[model samples]
Target: MTGSITIALDAMGGDDGPRTVIGGAAIALHRRPDMRFVMFGEEAAVRPLLDAHPEVDKASTFHHCDITVRMDDKPSQALRRGRRHSSMWKAIEAVKTGEADVCVSAGNTGALMAMAKVCLHTLADIDRPAIAAIWPTMRGESVVLDVGATIGADSKLLVDFAVMGGAMVRALYGIERPTVGLLNIGVEEVKGLEEVRAAGRMMREHDMKSIDYRGFVEGDDVGRGTVDVVVTEGFSGNIALKMAEGTARQIGEYLRSAMRRTWMSRLGYLLARSAFEHLREKMDPSNSNGGIFLGLNGIVIKSHGGTDADGFASAVELGYDMVRSSLLQKIVNDLNRFHTSDVPAVPAEQ
Candidate 1:
């Protein structure tokens, strides 16, 4: 945590391109003076932006890349066309080559995942990588995994997500033995998919030291912070994440509309302005913008493409946290423990 950490940035990946990326690097550099950057993008577009931020310019080393992955490109198409030449690919390469501790990109999620999996590869015993997001909860925050990585998980994959998610909590929050629960329709043993139930049974029977399995958690339990980590397939996890974001936006709009409805409402809003501001800060999606690709041999952070400078900075800071905490090693240790345990084989789908 004390030493200098280098991060690889895909400057051309986001909706706003180098402008947002450079601005974000400046903010992140200001906060963490020990952080350095290796930026990958077209020189003509990115260099001027970098030069404008004197602090970021001094701390960064830029590399020119001719290709930029299109937001609409499919994962297969991205892999075929942008494998080696794209800005996103080069940024991830920096992590693989040890030039940077982690890679951060606000690119197409599918393209980023494709490039990362091909370049960095998954850690041993990891069948598939998962995207883990930090969820704001009633207690504080919780880690949720498979938030749109690959869809459809078997029993074994769910257990793997639990191990990875627990490791992530330990890395970010310093929780020694994080509690984990499967995201399900109900908390009962008999509810939800067979694979989920089997995973629950497996975790209960094995009782892994790295995580405390808390059985099934209903969707509502996620916001309540019933457990430190929530595990689910990408399909459901992605839906839950989108729904939460939409609901937050909806509530904010409702509040704004109500505040302007009448003179009395406007006066009440003025009286409670500070509290409203606090609520806005808590509900802001930008605060929790980074989605970490867990199970990779190297760290890759996916930032929301539409995010602004502050949101992108949050993603860079997340990459810094993962590097500082030795997240990869912690995951390896956890997975090793789980694989060596007396857990039963995953039952086939009914």
Candidate 2:
């Protein structure tokens, strides 16, 4: 870990405003004593919360910003209205100016992404940025990219996601040459969209050392942990993410209902209380709360808007890990190598 890592917080961005952000920062500080914070929000709303958490208050330098982006604000509207003054914009600016290593926000996702792109800009050769989420798979955890960052992707963009996701896997999981798979409807070479097929051929031919390109994977393969990184355009990626989350919740509800249906089942639940507790912990969304915005010049983490303090803390820790692992440098190195390598041209789309 670095001797000291500073995180910028959009202190008034989330559903609970300063309460959730401050509490999460306090929790993060507890786990990482070397962490410091630069908080931006309304002074009146944030100061009282800071008073409640002396550890975070002492470690933090607060800046008052009267404006905040609303959750429903469109991306363009946010950019126009909150550009220089809003808490979200200032938080991102801190990263742009090197005032903080990373920025964490549980704010309007659209607004946050917009401000981040405008403030820090995309890295060289990256056409668009992506959001990579740490997914809880049966085998452990996998990195899934383009989870609602943008709506569509071409072959080149898909390749970019693969490289970026591979870098993130290495940073977060210490997996060198992480296996990457393109999420598709089928595993066959000719089974998916032309763009996906083209992307696959490009990856196979280039054979980048940073990632082992597995041909294609179906939706079920994601939870099976068939690959260390799952790459897809944001449209399908976002749908897959939401579906998986809903399924987890649905299954949990079914289990609860089944256990409460009869005295016998309730007794069985009691007999297996420890196992259930472990299962609950494993299924907890809070454990994997942060979605990393990749392919950017700086690190920015977006937490679930409705997540509690613990979940937000998980997001902060994610930023800490990214900085500690030197994620941006790794991505740049991979991109440079991939582009400079002598490789065959991508065949024309059928």
Candidate 3:
């Protein structure tokens, strides 16, 4: 469990660079003493931070990727002209060669996706790789997918996405009998255009192995966690996710400002310190940092661009959880089950 798991971090590809990247790396290593981070970035900046920290066992164990791929680099050009020794590319290569089990990046989303899909390729029988994030709600969290991965997913492709997303929710969160939904404009069964209606109908009738394709869900129902998994094409999913994240930040800032208004309010905040901290930690976007690039041949999690040490730590823990959970094997088993017709309407957990 300790040495068995290796995670590649894109040390040079974040908003804050080494300050936040290495700072967060320290916290991540401190939290999980057993984990090993193969940091890939400018060695000069990264090594000093690792040298200062005694808790991080193998901090010097880094791969120097002198060329950093910027967030604004065009996806196609980045792949065409980007440095061969860049951290992002090396990280993906590590997973491909089995030197690492998972790769985590706070880099360019499009670039990372392209590198992964182009380098690692999609799993057999799977159409495309999708970026999925867990939306926390009253019940727990629901998986939302194609978060800007594929633009125009056909009806059959979305049906495959539903199954893939359902498998992801089950592997990552241990959700058995996970309900699947196709995100649409309206809640009614036949309100959407041909593809949406067709997807809904396929979800109902399609024998999607372990996935219990529940039905269609509306935009507002995503954060509500109405179903275990929400499936949609890349265009709609990305817009909804960005909007939700922006709203969370706005409200969080308001809460902080209101708490600092007066002496009395500040005193009240002190009294409720623990609860406040807990809420803040829970609501922090960094804590929800890891996004699984589902349907890929291997695991790759892309952290947010603004992620700090705490966010990186969360990503590392997620990487560990993914490794320990044996997600790839679970998905493999699911694929086998699908082909052998071992899956029922609600397939039992393996």
Candidate 4:
């Protein structure tokens, strides 16, 4: 677990299938040569691409399966049709069976999540699982959870997300005591839903040593990096994530339009080309490619289906980092401490 990590890859997942998936694996291999991959897909497509990159081929263990879970397929449809035969299912099965340290897929989010929950199951004392995204912030990065995993979360679930997201931050950022915040419309305790307020009170009262609870953080604080972990129910988290992405894209478009509007602006852009490039790199969604599913017994990383090799590589690297940092163990230990610290299992409504 400490050394070279083995990754279970859904090679046939994603928009481009094996080409993009294997290409990404190749890119990851260049960065982490010690890493090994267990690929699941049809040999006809995967082998040739693996041959293109001898290094990945040498380090890979291929499991051929003709079936693929379609991108448009619903979770229930995928479960019924692509159960044991699909590449995605097999990849997740590797993690469940202890053959791989983590499972990575750039496939259908709903299907991957469904399969993962079925195969790995939830960790002990955990009810619902959450999807945590590494959000880029002004200070650096913060972990935000329940980003479209489920619609709504109870107060207890929100508290669980905080603990889970805090573990993610610790694992990825190497912070011993990361700050946690409940996402609210306002910083005032009375501004949000009772669930949010209750969750915040529990996090504050519990005095969990692993996380530095920073109380409520507004949506703007997400970009400002007000906390290391942003806890929210899935509905609002997903909306906020999408809104941020849209705003970034809109800003990029505006920058381009403004630069092209005048020769003087173009000259200025040329003078600051390097700075602009750095900003673009920072804003690129590809750099932050993985949405981690937390509270599961095993690690499952979901990459954007349309991302290229470099983007996929970022997701793979994230999985490797999580395995190296022993994220699951950290979450489990934190959960044990949280349950034993005399914190009420159910927070009283305000």
TM-score of each: 0.97, 0.98, 0.89, 0.97
Which regions of candidate 4 deviate over 4 angstroms? 345-350
- Candidate models: Cα lDDT each: 0.93, 0.93, 0.79, 0.92
**The CA-based lDDT of model 2 is what?**
0.93
The global Cα lDDT (0 to 1) of model 4 is: 0.92
Q: What is the lDDT of residue 100 in candidate 1?
A: 92
- Please give the clash total of every predicted structure, in order: 0, 0, 1, 0
lDDT (10s digit) by residue, model 1, range 237-348: 9999999999989989998998999999999999999999999999988898899999998999999999999999999999998899999989999999989877766544
Instruction: Look at candidate 2 and give me any clashing residue pairs.
Output: none
> Any runs in candidate 2 off by more than 4 Å, and if so which?
348-350
Root-mean-square deviation of each candidate, in angstroms?
A: 1.7, 1.2, 4.3, 1.3
Model 4 is weakest, by summed lDDT over 10 consecutive residues, at 341-350
Name the lDDT value of residue 267 in candidate 2.
Answer: 96
Q: After superposition, how far is residue 203 of candidate 3 from its true place, in Å?
A: 2.3
Indicate the TM-score of model 2.
Answer: 0.98
lDDT by residue (tens digit), candidate 2, 1-350: 55799999999878888899999998898998999999999999999998888889999999999799999999999999999999999999999898999999999999999999998999998999999999999899999999998887998889989999999999988998999999998787668888889899899888687899988999999999999999999999999999999999999999999999999999999999999999999999999998999988999999999999999999999999899999988999999888788756896655
In terms of TM-score, which candidate is stronger, 3 or 4?
4
Off by over 4 Å in 1: 346-350
Tens digit of per-residue lDDT, candidate 3, span 198-241: 77765565566588877788888887788898988899889989
